[model samples]
Target: MQVDSDPDWSALLIRVRDHEDKAAFALLFRHFAPRIKAFLRKSGASDTLAEECAQEVMATVWHKAHLFDPSRASVATWVFTIARNRRIDALRKARRPEPEDLPWGPEAEPEQSEALELRQETARLGEALRQLPEKQRALIERAYFGDLSHTEIADETGLPLGTIKSRIRLALERLRHQMS
Candidate 1:
């Protein structure tokens, strides 16, 4: 009967880096995959995601094994550090919010054609109001832009209430026809 000897992880990593050793990689995978998976799951990942991330961490180890420094950390420390960083990156990606699509908001832009039509209609209404008699223009301005009730306009202008209402009505009818 052959006795099983514990393999050196640092030597296995060096073999994988220098010689692309499959047996060394298999040894590393067998030793570390389950531990990495457990670490990820304990840190809040689902089992399926933990499995996938463990596979990625091992692939990184295979490619970057040459970067390991034995003086600074043991093979297990290096591998587990990589696994922890990968878990942080995955959590950040999962938690990020997607961008909002915004024609539905309160500040949404009007269509170009509709905006242009409103501008032209406003210009026409302004020209129609300018063409009115100055007395009528004054009464309309006081009632609408000046925010005055008929009684207020009459008090301000020393005009009869009936005269103020009639002038404003006629001015609005002219503006409607011109705009239409």
Candidate 2:
């Protein structure tokens, strides 16, 4: 019997779940890596950084392929979202002493996950983040999550300092607009 070719990405993910399927992995990597690179570039990553970030995203996909769920999002969307979150994480690492990460003795504040609905609300927040123009989203993610100062951000990103602030200001305004 002849085998069908160019199966859906969801099916490719199923193949990736098989422990020995290196070919499935290569196919998945080839398809998604360019999209990841384009995504990072649009989100204001320099070319070199975009390339490096795409590699990381694909590495993640290879490792996490078992976790792929068609119900959550299309394979492409899942991959891009991972890249987006990674970019934000890279852009905005914590600064100074984080309240939670503080090495306080035994009295540290206990942590808990947000409830299911609240987590969905935060997912809505993510969708809202995606709605903002790419530049605005990138700036806000970098500032809020990466905790970079305006000066440091500008120097690292090569964006004019004023543009950075404006994009962040606009992104926040958009978030409030969408959330309320």
What does each candidate score in C-alpha RMSD? 32.2, 10.3
TM-score of 1: 0.48
Give lDDT: candidate 1, residue 135: 81
lDDT score, candidate 1, position 179:
65
- Residue 149 lDDT in model 2? 74
**Cα misplacement distance, residue 50 of candidate 1 (Å):** 0.3
Clashes of each: 0, 3
Consecutive 10-residue window with the lowest summed lDDT within model 2: 107-116
Off by over 4 Å in 1: 1-5, 94-180
User: Per-residue lDDT for 38-96 in model 2, tens only?
Assistant: 76776567899889988998888878887665544557667866786777765555333
Clashing pairs in 1: none
Candidate number achieving the greatest lDDT relative to the actual structure = 1
- Model 2 spans > 4 angstroms off: 1-6, 94-180
